[model samples]
Target: MFTFLMMLLLFVPIGITVDLAEKVGKMLENDVPFGEIAFYYLDFTVYFANLLFPLFLFLSVIWFTSKLANNTEIVAFLSSGVSFSRFLRPYMIGASIVAGFALFLGMYLAPIASQGFNEFKFKYLKKNKSVQQTKDVYQQINDHDYIYVSNFIPKTKSGLNFTYEHFEGNELKYKIFADRISYVEKDSAYKLTTYLKRSFDNGIETVEKETQKTVQFPFELEDLTPVEYAAETKSYGELLDFIAAEKRRGSPNIGRYEVVKLKKWSLPVSIFILTIIAVAVSSIKRRGGMGVNLAFGIAIAMIYVFFDKVFGVMAEQSNFPAIVAVWFPNVIFGILAIYLLQNAKR
Candidate 1:
């Protein structure tokens, strides 16, 4: 409960500061209402809550454990025939709870909140929003087929430098290049209209007859949607489908999504491991004191982050299994925690 209050306290002000600073900067040259700026600030801050949560959990653990050690409660438990592992059981439980909360917020609440925040930015912050918008741009229209728009305006569903490619296995089958493409709203649906098409056949190029609508392909142009911003934006159910769909398509960036999905579970597990490790590291009353405990804890945390990031990058570029890549750091540290627990008990 106390930890939650601390998180709330830190989250609100930081959010406001960020929002107001941007608003003030924007307003110095333009006239925007104070109330609107305040609303934007609130929205910005709320969206950042997820990013702030991990630090909150880490600091809370450190502060709480430091107090426990300062009071010699942890030392007394170890001296009373209580194994360090047994003593750390509650800390593990607490970490699990925090991790659960983090997962819930990250997977569910954050996505919904992010939509509002992004909309606010697009509507208020962006100038010429249509020209700047980019979503549903370059998309895989079908297997072995791709559509790319050099720039797309999502609001108008218009694109410039449109290029479409069809591939047979690894060989290029047909390529169509267009100067511009636009979507026409028909009744309740939309139709894509192209202004130009250059088709390549038998290693020869010909300008296909230009028309607003043409059945020149095996796949429909409208079938593609933008790649999702990130897995975190999708619900847990959506994330599963997204990953499966991408994997089936032989998408390269799926490693990032895989890591994200695993992270939902792994983040919770990490809390438990770190709690055990912290208890083991701090169980002995060291001459260097809680400062030593903190330094060691921070060092371990930094090493964990470093390796996690490195593996994440490697996984992106290589054929490293996403599940293994994401969880390897945790597994290594978990073993370290167990070993330290045994040593500390003696």
Candidate 2:
């Protein structure tokens, strides 16, 4: 617990300091209010810590066990007829408790914090950028409907060069075009400028044009933009529902959303796997004392993080299965932990 607290103090402050250093200029330039900045940092704390929880937990385990090895406590316990597996029971129990807390954090608290964190970053620190795709936005809204926007601005909930197509089987039923489109919050509809519609019936085509029009579509304007980053802003149930809704729209980001959703659960499983690896790696004495074990643990942690990012990218960018991408690290590390534990048993 002491080591875990130390690790928390070590990582959180360093992260906050570096982030504030980089973003303070933006805050001043934007004239961001004091209360909003304070709340932003509060959310930043949870968002930052949740991302690196596994590393901190892993290091704390290594630090605690390494001290036991350096003090000959592990030797004393082994010589006292305590089986290796028996010695691991308390650690596993502790890991389970911690894992539960990690689950609560990722599922509930992190989403709330992440929403605030990302919103503040986009609103103040990243004014020149957007959370959603800003150009060539296109999607199949449903089985027979498709939508396109030459460009979009999420901040204004508006787009340019908007087009919507409806098909009857392989043939076009109708198509609509607009020079500009914007969501009307008060009316709960879309306002299209230079609106034009064409319909095909039998062997004839009809055209209609309007200078301005208010229309309703089966989709929301927010649905037109990229929503992978939005996944983290939703709670557990909300995320699942959002993914399901996005899937029906033939969203290309389904894989990415699934990655985010699965990652929440995967984190808890990793706590157990990392705990085993830490204990096994650090419970054996070495000539360099605790420092050697810590060095090795840090190296392993780096490798684990590398593996994680590689798979996460694959899942997000390609057809790689999100479940495999999320759980593969835990599975690989779980095997390593077993091997290391066997060696330590000898």
Q: lDDT of each structure?
A: 0.67, 0.90
Model 1, global lDDT: 0.67
lDDT at 330, model 2: 92
The local lDDT score (0 to 100) that residue 292 gets in candidate 2 is: 95
lDDT of each residue in 270-314, candidate 2, tens digit only: 989999999999999999998999999999999999999999999
Clashing pairs in 2: none
| Candidate 1: tens digits of C-alpha lDDT, residues 52-83 | 55445555566567777888888786778987
Off by over 4 Å in 2: 142-144, 155-157, 167-172, 184-188, 202-204, 226-228
Best by lDDT: 2
TM-score of 1: 0.72
RMSD (Cα, Å) for all candidates, in order, is 5.1, 2.2
